[model samples]
Target: MARALNDGPGRECPPALPFVLAVGVTGHRKDALPADSLLTLHDRLATVLKALTEQAAAVQEANQSFFSDAPPRLLFVSPLADGADQIAAEIALRLGFELHAVLPFDRGRYRADMSDEDGRVRFDALLSRATCVLELSGESDHHLESYVMAGRATVAHCDLLIAVWDGLPPRGRGGTGEVVRLAHDRATPTIHVPVAASDELKIRWSAFDPAVVTHAEDQANVRTFGEEELGAVLTAVLSPPPDEREREFIHMFQGECRRKLRTRIEYPLLLAATGVARLRRHHWRPEIGAVRTHEEWQTYCDACHKVAAVTTPIASLQSWYEWADTLASDYAQSYRSGHVFNFVLAAFAVLLALTTLVLPDAKKILAVAEFAAILAILLNTQIGVRRQWHRRWLDYRQLAERLRPMRSLKLLGLAAPDPPGTAANPTFGRWVDWYAAVVWRGMGCPSGAIDGDRLKAMASTIAEHELAPQVAYNKSVANQAERLDHRLEIVGLTLFTTALLGCVVLLLGFAFAPHWVKANSNWFTLLSAGLPAIGTAIFGIRVQGDYVGSAVRSEQTARVLEQIADRLTRNSSNLSRAGDLVEEAARAMHADLDEWRLLNQQHDLSVG
Candidate 1:
């Protein structure tokens, strides 16, 4: 069976999986709406939805590798308010889009806030039709802030925002204009449907511009969103970039392959060294299992399901993470083994060549063996470089780590955290970001009211499952790395010290016993040459692995996670506080991963 790196016992490798496109709505309520404008607004909104649906199909067809057989799911996110919200929900339902309602208050309070009986009835009808409802908790006195939170939540959850506005500034705290601004700030695509009688109903894309004035004239001046423009936007958001290397990597990762023999051979040495070190230590017990198993993942999903109102595709996210994690482990083993074997081969080649001096009768055989060793080194390095084992290991590990936190982030309505400086570093794998974002969009938000009780439950679950396990894993990694570094350092030092003693012995023998020195000179030469060559090789492996650096980074990360876990335990009931802790934990993990990538990227396989 193929082994996973740092995987917990009983972990199973799974096979590979598409995404959901969420469209949100923000517009004026019925009381403020012009009667004549409603019909045109409805028509334009429907047209945009239809265009999106059609364009999604085209993009899926073009990029079938990225998606499954099922077409992309279209989710309509709305608060189901009296006017524009209800209108968009109705149109979305008619177009077969799944409605996910995000309300500022619970259903009862939201219904009672409607001014008229007819509006209340419409609201209930739409609410009943919604596939899932996310009710936000808010006190009566702070209803305006709640509305702002709801609007921001809707914008955060959706891929596209449809603002049915009158091309004017927001009159209230959380109205159509405010939602549009939130969407703009988030860089979510928005389609503006003019509801003002004076402004024509020409649908256009509202590109986010930080410098643009928040006025009707400036908003209306943007270019019209025609069919081609909409298609371009959909394609850009939905499809991964046309990078052939990434595509090839996906194929290789998903294909069935056995573990490399070199990696298998190296594992026992690593295991023995770490196992001895762990046996020597006594104070720390693992907080959680070292490896994450399928059963553990199921437990996590069960916790999420218990609190969630609607069914979330969390298992799908797990499968993606598992697939990436498995591949990353495989590549890590291969890449690390490649360097180890190269170092060993280089030292062996030196030893073999030096043996010719000791046994001159076998010079031809030693020369042939040394030549083969050199050839093997060239072959190994070439294969590693050509196959990109190091590159794939870094990329897949980065992707897996990003996906790992989504289990908690999705529940909190937070997107996957990006590596720092991703925008500035053009070499960063943008396709990884696109892939993670697609998974996040596909999972969407769990529909339900997050009361204080639910907030506390989710926080506890995160602490127990997410943060605790990571803390344990990081500590274990740090210990293991420190132990390996220490062992290698000792071994390298012993070899060099013995070589130095051999030199002193050879010097003393030449002065005191010339005949004895002449008889045993080959032994001294082997000691002086072979020991140092092997010692240098060992040193090279140590540097290439960067075990000491890894230990320090992992230890620091463990401390940060412990701090976050403590804060989460204390502020479990506060939703904002819990969300902040989760983000902080995620940032810490991302920082660690970034450091690991930087440390390993420059240590690619080389003959030296």
Candidate 2:
């Protein structure tokens, strides 16, 4: 049975920690800011932070089941630059938010870039106050690129961005304007706090595509940043959207229970028939309530500890991954089994109907049996559809897979990229991306420097824990799918061939001896008609499963992962190269997932 990580031999599991709301800041430096307007900017920043904190508390209280007993936490992400970043960070600190500083360079070099002794002193004071500081890895000569990267990282990590801008274009590569644009591009909600009195404060609510706007000032759906608008944005970020379908999904995810006996029986039968049992003999029997145990979590924790000390964020993410992965496995089994059972039930129903010809005196009984069989198929399909088995499996698996690679990504201070075009509008009824963003915010950025030794360790961990295992899994899947497809084809063809032989025999018997032909007509009819129906059912299942297509895709993916693994081995010490390879491997896996989802989406369980 599955037990919680903290559960003892007989103890119940504890609830998970509450969600975090991360807000980031980017704006003009001290030199660019008007000296007289500093107090106003400070007050505006304070208002925004205070409003978000109150809104977040209300959201968590309203949805107690979605959160833990503890209240939701606020995280403030900033680069702690001389002007706007520091102002926002100070306000956030006063509001009881945890401060996470993302610096463009190490302390000494960064301090050297400050204009005056006062600025440097303030930087040191705030840096000392921060809970975590992530100094990005880069040389002093490439400072501009590092700053741009820092801006991107801030946007990537935060749930919301606060830009203390002056309603103008960027003055340089990593200016406040550039950061705001990055937030717009990534669809991160932003509250634009004007540095001047004339410009109106606005919020880019992330509801429309910025690409459609011809002018910067004319960005689509820019709303005035007021109490009501900020409340709406905060509500949207703190919880799943108000769509009914999305609400249903969240409920199901929270419930996390399954009871599908038909699935348990049907899934194994399909596996056995398709030759998948040859790969794993355990498929011959049903699972005996195998669940993720506490021991399994301990093992994962041990692995993570080997890479680095077990931090709160790492442990939290690992726990979530385990929960999602297990739920995904259960749903996948149930969904796949529903379809397989439909195919078999369809075949059996026809065979039951054909039994009337073989036993004419018991036609009524056969009719009832056939009706029951057909009913079973319909009921199975209806249950699968109403419960959203297929969608839950895909979405939960996507969530789990995305979380799987974060250990490495977090070490290098990288965030997973959102799906293409999701910036405008994410997929309906799918909140996995949103959930992931929230969790990423909770984790914040890694709190240290990225050095050559750390890069080597990350490379080794990825190769051992991620790429190598995935390569093996893909290879296994390729072989299983290829074998199953080939075996099913052979079995289907043999059934049809036997039916032809049966027809030939019936014709010969009719010509040689009419009485004999009439006496055994029922058996011959079954051989000719029943066998063909069974063969057609098998063909339908094979086509719907797309075994051949799966084999090809898995093989190609395995090859790509193997190549990435090789590169990791060659360039283990290069952090930039390792980051790229890790991303490449993740992309390959994501592409494969997209292809698999597309292939099976149209193959919903049906009587046909």
Which lDDT values do the candidates have, in the order given? 0.74, 0.74
Task: Highest TM-score: give the candidate number.
Answer: 1
lDDT of 2 by residue, 1-608 (tens): 11233334543232344678889889888998999889988888888888888887877776565555565778888988888888888888889998888888777888888877878888898899988888766557877667776787788778789999987887777678888887776667889999896677888855644344323355675888878888777776777656766666665565564333333546666667565773243332223233333344455456656655214367777767766776677777787778777877788888888788889899998889888988888888899888788888888888877776776667666444553224445322356665666566678777877555655766776777678878998999899888878888888999999999988888898889889989888888777888998899889878877889999999999999999999997898655577678878888887898888888877776665
- Candidate 1 per-residue lDDT, tens place, 1-608, comes to 11231133643333433556888888888998888888877887788788888887888778776555565788999988888888888999999899888888778888888868988988888888888788876545677777776787787678778888876777788788888776654556678788874564433333323234333335543556777877776766676655777655554554434332233235335446545332211111111121345667888878777766334567788877876776677678678878878888899999998898899999999999999999988998999899888988898888888888888876764333432122222122456766677777877766767776777778888888899989999999888888787888888999999999999998899889989999988989988999999999889888898888998999999999999999998897655567668978988998898889888898887775
All models, RMSD in angstroms: 5.6, 4.3
lDDT of 2: 0.74
Clashes counted in candidate 2 amount to: 0
- Residue 388 error, candidate 2, Å: 4.0
TM-score of each: 0.86, 0.86
Clashing pairs in 1: 7-291, 8-291
| Model 1 residue 578 lDDT score | 71
